[model samples]
Target: AQSVTQLDSHVSVSEGTPVLLRCNYSSSYSPSLFWYVQHPNKGLQLLLKYTSAATLVKGINGFEAEFKKSETSFHLTKPSAHMSDAAEYFCVVSDPGGGYNKLIFGAGTRLAVHP
Candidate 1:
């Protein structure tokens, strides 16, 4: 069984500061990882993903994550945070089996931006 844990339920950032969200996972085999963001009442959008190609993956909105197999961690980071960056972020892990993907979603991290 694989699972993901979000270290913090909420994160607050200043308008122009950097943003960091922590995530940890436990999996029997190497799994695919992803980060998705959702605004107030909008749908979820893919921030980035790692599918066994590159250890470092970049996504939209200047966000990126590095796959650290040894640490079993995939943390999301942004060089600078913007007002629009304020949203709920989810860390997800998927296992590819028999030509199918089983996804496990994280609880979610709520990001608050202060002006």
Candidate 2:
């Protein structure tokens, strides 16, 4: 079983400020980690992925996350926040042991960018 916990349900930031969203995970097997961003009423777009390959993964829209096995964490970070960056971010985990290759999504962190 693989699971993810998003530390913040909501994050607010001023435009041009740094953005950070925290996440933690637990998996039975070596799992794939992913961060997905969704715009208003839109589908999820893959920001980055950690497939037992890279410890530090970079994603689109100037977002990145580091997979820390010891801390059991995969926290997303961005140098600057844009108005467009205001959206929902989901922390996901893929279980290799599970045959279906389903991704479990966190409740989601809603990012609000203030002008």
Candidate 3:
């Protein structure tokens, strides 16, 4: 079984400050990891993904994550925080054995950007 755990349920940051969202995963095989953001009244958007192509993966909107096999971590980071970045972020893991579409979603971490 593959699963993901969001370390923080809520993260707060001031505008223009650095942001960090931690995630840990457990899988029997080499798994794919992803970060998805869901804004209020909006659909979930793919922030980034790690599929063995690279350890460091960059995504849209100044977001990026590094896959660390030893640490079993895929933490999301940003240089600066923006008000627009506030949303519910979900750390996801793919269930390769089940199917490509089979995914395990974390509870979610709500990001709050204070002015």
Candidate 4:
């Protein structure tokens, strides 16, 4: 089975509003979870990650996510949204089972922050 799945392909939020992006994952071993954001024609930046160390992870630009092992979910959330937050978000997973880190990327979720 695919290791990572992003529940939404697109999400829209008004400026100064909250934003949420859903993701789920399945891994054989303890995995590292990451949320990456990409601006238009730009490289991706890591927003946050859960490495079996913390359940609640904080990230830059007022973003955060909680790792729920029981639910097998990691969802990104922001209390207030900004226009600059409009971009494509990816949920990534890294499994260290094979002695090497194998990164798996979700299809992607495009977030639109409106004015």
Per-residue C-alpha lDDT of model 3 across residues 10-109, encoded as one tens digit per residue: 9999999999999999999898999999999999999999998989999999999999999999999999999999999999998888555588999999
The 10 consecutive residues of candidate 4 with the worst lDDT sum are 95-104
| Cα lDDT over the full model 3 | 0.95
lDDT, residue 69, model 4: 87
Candidate maximizing TM-score: 3
Q: Model 2: which ten-residue window has the lowest total lDDT?
A: 94-103
Ranked by TM-score, the better of candidates 3 and 4 is 3
Q: How far is candidate 2 from the true structure (C-alpha RMSD, Å)?
A: 1.0
lDDT of 2 by residue, 1-115 (tens): 7899999999999999999999999998777999999999999999999999989999998999999988999999999999999999999998766477888999999999999
RMSD of 4: 1.1
Residue ranges of candidate 1 with Cα displaced over 4 Å: 97-99
Estimated TM-score for each candidate:
0.94, 0.96, 0.96, 0.95
Point out where model 4 deviates above 4 Å: none
Clashing residue pairs in candidate 2 (N, C-alpha, C atoms within 3 angstroms): none
How would you encode candidate 1's per-residue C-alpha lDDT over 1-115 as one tens digit per residue?
Answer: 7788989999999999999999998887778999999999999999999988999999999999989999999999998899999999999999665658888899999999899
Instruction: Please tell me which model should have the higher lDDT, number 1 or number 2.
Output: 2
> Would you list the C-alpha lDDT of every candidate in the order shown?
0.92, 0.94, 0.95, 0.92
**lDDT tens digits, residues 34-109, model 4?**
9999999999899998988879999999999999989999999999999999999999999775577877899999
TM for candidate 3 is 0.96
